[model samples]
Target: MQFYCSKAAAEALETTQKGKVKSWLEAAPVPEAAGPWAWQVHAIKLARQNVFIVMERETRFAMVFWGIKKGDGETLLKQFYERMVNLLLCMNQDVNWLNAADADVAIEQILQRNKRYCFVAGVDRSVQTHINEVARFCEGEVHEIGSLLMDADEAAGFDEAMNDTLRSVRGGDYFYPNAVFFCSWARQYAGASDELCLELEARFQRVRHERMAMRVAKHSDSSIPVYEQIMAVLQGKGLKP
Candidate 1:
């Protein structure tokens, strides 16, 4: 994703050690030629595969940062700065009011987030299963939300649920409905009329729970199959396992 930050506004944010900023006001359009003064400030990455350009808005005389991601963050930022300086020098514009960009809270979050895949251990073998599982999860969430809209007793509750589901989907965070795992199997099964979709979701859930059970069993003593444990719980609840 490309993010834009104005030059004057960017300076107000605290800088971090992660990236450096530079000015590109006099950058050249080509290797030997320079670009307009409006195209001045640039934030370069020290690494490869990443680049950022900060352009000035002619009308407002404001600078904005535009970043490209494809390399390590540090390298990209450094290169971005170096390229801006070369471009400016070629264009014959004195570099002024240009410095490294500060790091911010959002940058910290980006660094702290879990970027590595949790299931990378068996990615080759489990890739297909993982894709199917994700599809089932998406379909199930949409189906569940649709059911809730159809069965809600209050108009307010239905509206709220619809809004919430839309927001979550737009934010790319939709997943399996957790309540279905604990609810009566019959109640959960009744939500979907499409037998195939329901079966796919259930199978996906079963395999997931089985994996979890195996992990748990590895550290403990449990002879029961994971499915059996789930079925027993359903039976005790007076629902078909």
Candidate 2:
């Protein structure tokens, strides 16, 4: 989906308080290394400073939501929604066509009781670590997932925790894969055919590893734990020292 802010709105962004600008862009609490906003930066690279636009590839639609700076969170939120609604109207789309974060509870309660929209949340390491806290609220089938961006050690820890959580799940099937490696040898463990569950775990680990590598390469100067973890994964994967 694509959206563009009016020229006035784009200009307003520059005059918006630095704090407000940070919040609007969902910038971190502390400054991150350079180019962290590469995607967003690329979007606004040559645009008229007064226009804010978002384009979605799937729908080939551009949405223009106006940004306003205000000290009152409630008022700001109201205005934000109104701007979103106005944008939807201009595009000749229903207000329900928009996607936002975690407002599922309220939106589902009022607008689409039929549950037309399904939101799948991507759980990161921190959220995965507190599985119980998440599972308490996330009631549904869980596909055992992991990140491959971590080193074998970190991945191993994550694997164990995932298995534990899988065991404790209220209702659902657990699926994963088995390691074909036998220590330093290439022999598959005897009598241990890889389960679907084990395969899922391995898949998650690989994806996590790749994601970590990308992150590390993208922010080479950052000293964040994610960067360190990515480096560790690269070393473990024999892709780096």
Candidate 3:
């Protein structure tokens, strides 16, 4: 998530909005971190129905893109992701041209693009019997983008997501990776087939949506039941309602 800007970019940004531009640049993620990083991209409505979110899962840092037109699958994500990465490194309006980098796009070269940086294919979570969230821009094929972007564009939603991300990374949220939920489920289902394990994951997500509908007044990490469902399934018990 560390960023580096050219001397010119820094100089130009320093003057804009009395350093608001520079501060925003300093605060946003540049996406070059070596990562087992998680990402999710999907569309939402704003000034248009075409808004898309680009986010890093662990950091919960996000960017929103708008006025998109659907294109071929990989073409759509790569084009936008390339733009998103470049936008992060440069000023808001224009891309920086760095003679120092060996390639025309340093981060794209660094990330190795589809080989590692972006997901060209879709997982199409839309098929789940629960809710259908098609990445409408990806030609109805879907990838596992997030539920967060619907709310995260706002400061309150952004802070809440960032807080939950930090807490989850530190193992506070039971349903987060490496936390008690996943760890316990992994322990119980160590030898299970991949499909079976994925089913458990799906059920957890379903329960999460149901819980989110009943948003709590003192919101924090989702409570224990979401975690419990996975364990119950792995232990050969039926899923809980």
Candidate 4:
């Protein structure tokens, strides 16, 4: 199935902060790195069901929604995109770079090749090593959902913590008081992914011994049992509480 944007959808898209996405992407000094609006999509089997994970790479915020009927991959993908775009619009974000893997036919429908492509934006809790890892939330895949949350209750808790985290993010907090929440969200949703890092997941190769080098290293110190360093980093820059 092809992805279509109706007139209403296009008109509605124009009304969003997604335009900031376009504006930001063009003005961004580092185009090669993931933009503030970049996102990643993955379809995985979990709880004996198909789950769609759409994650904003920079923000590291994710929304999990169920998508059944795995027979038509394209159809499922299209549905995922539709919901994701709606969610993005709600959050006042849009996509500049979208990363996925090994699905050429499904991926091509959304690429506009320097045109006004619409997408903008879109996890979690752990039961935490550090905010250091949540600080680097973009370096993993979403398909390892099974390994992270385990079951429905944990997943539900994930959504709750994530909703709270989103509230903090929307409040324009560079570093929130409850920074530990970010670590919990990251550990379950973004950490411990099976896929190799880098946005080019299509060419993502799992190198031997690559498993040892984790994207998120647990932080600790003799002074503190574990460092929730996000606030410390901000305080260093004179972010007054």
lDDT of 3 at 72: 29
Count of backbone clashes, every candidate in sequence: 32, 35, 1, 4
Worst 10 residues of 3 by lDDT: 126-135
TM-score per candidate, in order?
0.20, 0.19, 0.29, 0.28
Model 1 agreement with the true structure over 1-241: per-residue lDDT tens digits:
1222233223322243558643322221233222122222223232221123222212111111223433233443344334333332221111111122322232232223322211001111222223233334334544666421122133223222221221122235433332122121212222323554455446545654565467656755477765666666546745553
User: RMSD to native for every prediction?
Assistant: 24.4, 21.1, 17.5, 19.6
Error of 4 at 69 (Å): 3.1
Give the number of the best model, judged by lDDT. 3
Model 1 scores what on Cα lDDT?
0.31
Candidate 4, which ten residues in sequence have the lowest lDDT sum?
A: 121-130
List the candidate numbers ranked by TM-score, top first. Answer: 3, 4, 1, 2
Shift of residue 140 alpha carbon in model 3, Å: 27
Q: What are the per-residue Cα lDDT tens digits for candidate 3 across 117-154? A: 32322222321111112224222322334332333134
Q: Look at candidate 3 and give me any clashing residue pairs.
A: 124-142
Best candidate (score: TM-score): 3
Residue 20's C-alpha lDDT in candidate 2? 52
By lDDT, is 1 or 2 better? 1
